[model samples]
Target: MKLLSAFAASLLWAIPAQGQTDPSQAALEAAAMLEQASIALTEADSARDRVRALTGTIQAYEAGLAAMREGLRKAATREAQLTAELRAREKDVAQLLGVLQTIETTAPPVLMLHPSGPLGAARTGMMLSEVTPGLNAKAEALAKDLQEVQTLRILQQNAADTLTQGLSGVQDARTRLSEAIADRTDLPRRFVEDPVRTAILISSTETLDGFASGLAEISEGEIAETDASISDRKGDISLPVQGILLHRAGETDAAGVTRPGLVLGTRPRALVASPTAATIRYRGPLLDLGNLVILEPQPGLLFVFSGLQEVYGEPGQVIPEGTPVGLMPGETPEIGAILSTTSDGTGTDRSETLYIEVRQDNSPVDPESWFRTDKDG
Candidate 1:
């Protein structure tokens, strides 16, 4: 797109004779922009795929941990049951022993006084002794079983401890995978700037669908407009936008949907990325957000969406449906105002503008998805 000189070129009051430049040039530029956007789209899609795989791995670990937890629960329940039963049996054994002792001691005394009698206390004592062996054996067996239960409790504890450790490890791995996939957001930005050369970049995007596929309540970012930057690696790709939210989950009201978002950076130039590929980690308050968030996007990258003036506020690109990302760097008083529809056939309507960012983990990503496919491409 031809940028107007900051100071409108001084007008020469001469009559024009040559034909006005054809609109074809603009179309050509648009075509080029579309081509570059396509490449970015492909990269974003691939990154998403990798993230999904990592997420699945994490889920598997969680499942394993859940199973282990269930086992521990069962073991604990069994131990409790065994202990209750053992206590009951011990009480019975104690009562029986006390009665047998009383009888043996008293009966012997009575028989000893009549030592000469044929049916003497000595004979009775022998009978009691015969039964005592079996009684003692029964008590001993119960005691042994009780001790076994104690041993089982200890064993179960050990198993539970081991499983807990394993579960923690799986969780750590899952976190790493999630962070890795998120970091890919930066790839498209870098690829777009140099397409064939650059290794790292930070840019903006809009216009493409599923670009924020996994995000919650995502909306389109800035739109393509005459005054906007409308930059393209090759040509013109323009599409305006309005507010968008990733992880599009939130409460809706008559005004609009209040989706959840992490409003990063009250500080200018800090709104590098949203939750998709980037995040904020702060040990101290982010001034307005109150808490610091550390976000790991993956591939050894960490993004912190901090310096936020507010934490529970909103974020992402803004513009009419076709607004270009990062094109209108300044404020637009015509936020909700209508503009002529650029599509095939539609009446002019209204729209707003929004900024957009893509980050892999905590770094920024190029935002080219928010533009139209150039007619030529």
Candidate 2:
């Protein structure tokens, strides 16, 4: 009788717990996840396109400045030659004036009082008429040279100002680009699993990939239906972060460990975003990776963004594309921790690195082949 009573008590506790799990609510959560993922993916692509366009503008400005410099060089040469010619002409005109003055004071009066009288004066009048026109022509040439030099100087100044303004604009665009990326924080959560399992998994995992794979299995939740899958957009997505591609999949690192993903070098405190919409499966620090976040865009596919200095969003959260998920470390040795272990000959000292991994069914794949560097390719 006592054994039967204990069995009934256990059944009662199990029934309510099972009843609390609602099927319709789970489906709704899944639908919202899918819709938000689609929107986030679109936003991610647009962000990349904007960055590309801004980079192109900066390049165009640089080219224009180069052309202007070349043109200015030629103009300056012309000005130099014109200035030298003007100086010579002025010297010749000065000598001509001295001679004309001597003739006016001495030759004119002498001609008027000469034995030949009026005939000599008539000859002097004709000479004076010819010299006066030559003097007027020299004055006009000098004025033209001065005007040309003044115009060249003005043009050079204007070009310098224009180039300065263009550089300032480029700097502003760069600042705005960083700001836009950092401001993308629109993640909403439906649930978050307990951290004990995550802590245990991190402790036992040998590799980050292995740690992420374990997370994939443990972080499974309600099914979400989307219009498209991440697999459907292969080679049509943007990189999650804005920076130079420093390493590709299968590349060995400085420590001789080979990882199967792309590495990007980004600025300090740079905000990292998702390349596509996804549900946060894991967000925390690991052994080597200081702070990390894992995203489940679909059931089998997982994106591990390691090397974060700070993280936002929780597991089971649905994040839109281009949403700011975390921040890069601004200070070193923490900053140094995020830098690329492998150099593809493209990394610099001013930037830190973001390690990205894409896993499908627990297998790593090359992200470079998946991300679209250009809109078409």
Candidate 3:
């Protein structure tokens, strides 16, 4: 019996622990996306449209980073739960180890012969037979948990390098994209911008409403009209950037100010695009608001985006849907900061805000009604 117990323990130790649950799917997907982004970066250098190519690369990096962060958060949470569970089961584990030690040390003849004679020995054998399975099962479960904990730790350790590469690749792509946009001169323009009129309008208008109302005054010539209309897609338009809605239209802010627009919380340097093909009516610093882009998707509908660090495209040029318009203001976080935020799961990495206001025929409308607020990207 002692030899049998020893053999069992040897077998348990020799066999690798098989986790009951699958590895994190999010982590796997994140790795795949990061790898693709790496490949895309290499291919972007030779692409015909460098701007579009770099844009795709940047998007891939963003998705990979987001997924990686989520995966790390889950791993951290799982590790904590397993640690707590193991601590709680300390007594059970100690008893299990004691039972194993006692079995290994006891003489087979003495273990078979109980104090009360043959009947006692038979009862003891029966009890051992029933309890042995439970012990083995508990040992297996413990092994699986330990293995998972080790795996999670290794994943987190290796994630730092992967995140660093992803962040660097994305920044490089953004720089290349900006240069490509600057060199771009093929886009068609509907009208020429009169800087003097624009300056005059800015000086004269106190509110956004007044500035928007006077946009036509800044046009040097007749604005070529297009039949472009997104009325069919009203109430279902995707947001121009990947972010969470921080404040709703007419909601009061910490500064005791309320506006008829939606504020989006986004990660640093997040890309802002046009949700639909539209004409750029204005693109510059507006009263109090930072760099802004005002797009007219249709004759009566205007989509205003504010709080950009750098604006793209000339005013009066019509850009297609998903065209890169601007980038949010802020610097990319360090790997340590990213990991800390991931472990905390507080979503504080979204440090930049983008203000979105939709106007219909010179009247401000609820941006939530026009945008799908449920989407994160």
Candidate 4:
């Protein structure tokens, strides 16, 4: 859970040190800022979604390529079988030719019109009838083998073409995702140019408590506003990252310490987005946590997320729903991690966990109470 200390240290000291004189005016300004942030967040989200969709497409293509290669292998095996059969048929024909040669030194027409007489003619007719059926059957089998070989070759070529196209599609998706990440203009900021104040805040806070107190003082001047309250969207908000829910609020661990929020196991380098538009409460390293972010969906409710390798927005910024806030640390999957929506055994490779805390009136609340999806532990 993010207490006063983590909140203070991670956030920028942009809120005026002195309190605002007109609370109503400050609230109006805050609302206006949120509106701007919401607009920017919407634009950023659209771009991010496009990139995410492309990544999914690339992964799907990779799965398809694997299947196609397996099919091609099976087809090639069939072709080999047909080739072997054709060679055996050819050997049988050669043996039959040798027998025919030993039977008579004359051509087929001569044998049919032999100079010997009716007895010789009747003997030739019986021999011819016996040999004809075998020759015709051999010819028919050879034709079928040749046709099958042609079909397999065609299938192999088509599969190769499909794999090539799939590769190209994946590359395109990667390029677009990179471009979307680079575009950050749509993000709205709460901090203007206060480098000196930020530096002083960083230097002054040595302990978590001091940091929290300092931040509380700084935030006294700012106002909080949102279109909807956290309580208003209970059980309908999407998760910040795609993954399996590992734990739920009040769940105890091996140490017998009960958790105050949800723990999710997700893909490496997975994109983390804001479940809803809210002010950036905190964004930086917290004690024992890698990189953490806290959001204020409304004045009394705080949503805390930690375990990111890189962070995007600042403490004073307002972010849109679905706007990417950070990425988990680790190498992205080669075929892109599977993000199956269903509980089927399709995606089972998630290896990282994100800690999510929902606090109301500074007390930890059950996050499952607000999520649309069901929780695990």
The candidate that wins on TM-score is 3
Count of clashes in candidate 2: 2
**TM-score, per-candidate, Cα-based:** 0.27, 0.47, 0.89, 0.49
Which residue runs does candidate 1 get wrong by more than 4 Å? 1-49, 91-155, 185-377
Question: Over the stretch 253-350, how does candidate 2's per-residue lDDT look in tens digits?
Answer: 77787788877776555557777888888888877877888887777788888888877666777876765567677642221222212112233533
Residue 248's lDDT in candidate 2: 76
TM-score of candidate 1 against the unseen true structure: 0.27
Candidate 1 lowest-lDDT run of ten: 1-10
> What are the runs in model 4 whose C-alpha is more than 4 Å off?
1-183, 186-230, 254-257, 334-348, 375-377
Q: Write the per-residue lDDT of candidate 1 for residues 62-151, one digit (tens) a residue.
A: 334333333434445555666776575564556555654655577555634444565655655565555556555555655555665666
Q: Worst 10-residue stretch by lDDT in candidate 3?
A: 7-16
Residues 1-377 of candidate 3 have per-residue lDDT tens digits of: 45445444543423334564344667777978998999999999799887778888888898898888888888888888888877876766676667767866889788879878899899778766765775677677777889889988888888899899999889988988989888888888889999999999999989999999999899899899889888888789999888878899999989998999989999899999899999999998988998999999899889999999999989999887888999999998889987776835555678899999999999999987778888765
lDDT of every predicted structure (CA atoms): 0.33, 0.59, 0.85, 0.58
lDDT value, candidate 2, whole model? 0.59
User: What is the C-alpha local distance difference test score of candidate 1?
Assistant: 0.33
User: lDDT tens digits, residues 79-183, model 4?
Assistant: 676677657656454554444454457576666775688777887678666655554454455555577688766655544344444445544544555566565
RMSD of 3: 4.6
Q: How far in Å is the alpha carbon of 363 misplaced in model 1?
A: 32
**Who wins the lDDT comparison?**
3
How would you order the candidates by lDDT, starting with the best? 3, 2, 4, 1
Q: What is the lDDT, from 0 to 100, of the residue 150 in candidate 4? A: 80
